[model samples]
Target: MTGDAAAVAAERVAGVAGELAARVTAYDALRDHRAVFAYTYFRLTSDLAAGLRTNNPPFRAPEWVADLSVSLAAAYFAAMDAIDTWLGPVPDARPGGEVLSADLPETVPEPWRDVYAASTVRHSYVLEEVLFSMMAHMSYDLPLALRALAARGDVHHRIADFHRMNSLLASSVDVVQAEIATRYCRRLRSLDRLFVRDDELFTSYGIRVARGLAWFNCDRLLDPDASAEALGSISRSTAAFIAEFRSPDDWRRRRAFQVLRALVPSRRQWPAPAAPVAVGSSPG
Candidate 1:
């Protein structure tokens, strides 16, 4: 039984997501950043899909996976919208000669490209996936985005906005983990301790550290020497790091990463969450 077939099935891919992009791209003053914003729309959509809600946070999978994924989607969504506000549609509104500026296709840019490439690594722990994804976005993609636009009108504001959106993203982490992780711990009692450690590091400090790197990269973008070479190096190196980085083999401390990773849920057994139900309408 159906009325309009299209309406019956939600299109979550880029639904309503492009409003920010549309607003940003419409500013004639922001012509250069058009593609960057467009690609960002695609990513927000993708992450929305990744973290789509499910009844069971954990059968076998780690709970934080979906929460982190959803938080990132929301962060990027807010970040893009904030950029629109920051740049100001009125050409004469801000510094830097009238204005400042701001996908998913195989043709998309880096950091994100690295994220997509790493998407195939299903074996990564949920926290690992979260960190790696953040690294690619903050450290690689963002600075590269500013680099492409070549606008430094309000550098301080740019940094502030970056952190503001970050705070927005971080605010959700506590709530998500508190709710989902409790249930996940019940399901796999043995792994609860490992998951707890992951949460502590991630929430207490790991995320902020990564954000610091991202802000630093934004600073680098302002450099004339930071061109394609800089972006390329960051992208390549970050991808490799995401693939391989782990806690160090310790001294006699006996708390080794291998021990924690061994306790990580087997994707084979628990399986990553399924593709989420489409929730909203797609952007044309």
Candidate 2:
């Protein structure tokens, strides 16, 4: 990686403040929002920050949640700086002093356009799949987390949006990831006879997991006891599969199986039945 890449990775910002504000002002006004809402919000921001610092391209978020948060922040500042630099030349709108629209057209617009485009990347793609994966990841023991909270009873509007949008966003990312993984494997193995060893090769994969974790902040996944149970089962099954691979005898086989297993949730964590509709359903 380049020095610039390292610099970018080292960069940090306070997104937690924003998340907290949203929870207090916009999310469910009742239902002990602190217990369920704040934890998920903070967890998401924390995970997002970690993911960005450790991502490939030195800090590219493989999935859209982190991509949206980090890129939007970067894009916002970059655009502002560009605008400030452009404005620096202009002293005043004094008569005989011509304000140049030409300069604004040239330098200012391009950066802003780029920034705006970067900001909305998540809204335009599959995020649900990421949410689904995050729900199943073993790190949080999400099943226990949800069960501890028990049934939330009624769905709050903010929670509803979080579930539906996150799931859809993750779904988009999954499609892209599957396609990218296929190409990465094919080219690295047989298609181009290319050497596979590279430092950044695994960066994308890590970012994917990080963003996946952020997506899990969707409140619906965390509140529903059944969904949590489902996730718990999948996590255990995945852990079991990975354990088998840890033995020296199964190294190569396990590695290959890992790739195949990547798409499927751990069977142990996966619920045998569909989760109850506490909120509404996603569009078919």
Best by lDDT: 1
lDDT of each: 0.42, 0.33
Model 2, poorest ten-residue lDDT window? 275-284
Worst 10 residues of 1 by lDDT: 55-64
Per-residue lDDT over 245-270 for candidate 2, one digit per residue giving the tens place of the 0 to 100 score: 22225466556544534453321111
lDDT for model 1: 0.42
Please give the RMSD to the true structure for each candidate, in Å.
16.9, 22.7
Off by over 4 Å in 2: 1-140, 148-163, 172-235, 244-284
Question: What lDDT score goes with residue 259 in model 2?
Answer: 53
Model 1 agreement with the true structure over 1-284: per-residue lDDT tens digits: 12222121112323433443344334313432233323333434433322232211111211222222333445455544454454456756633422111122333444554543443332344344445555656566555554443352444544443454445345445543443233222333344344444344346265466666655665675766875566666767655665445543353223555565456443312212441222242222
* Candidate 1: residue pairs that collide: 15-281, 39-103
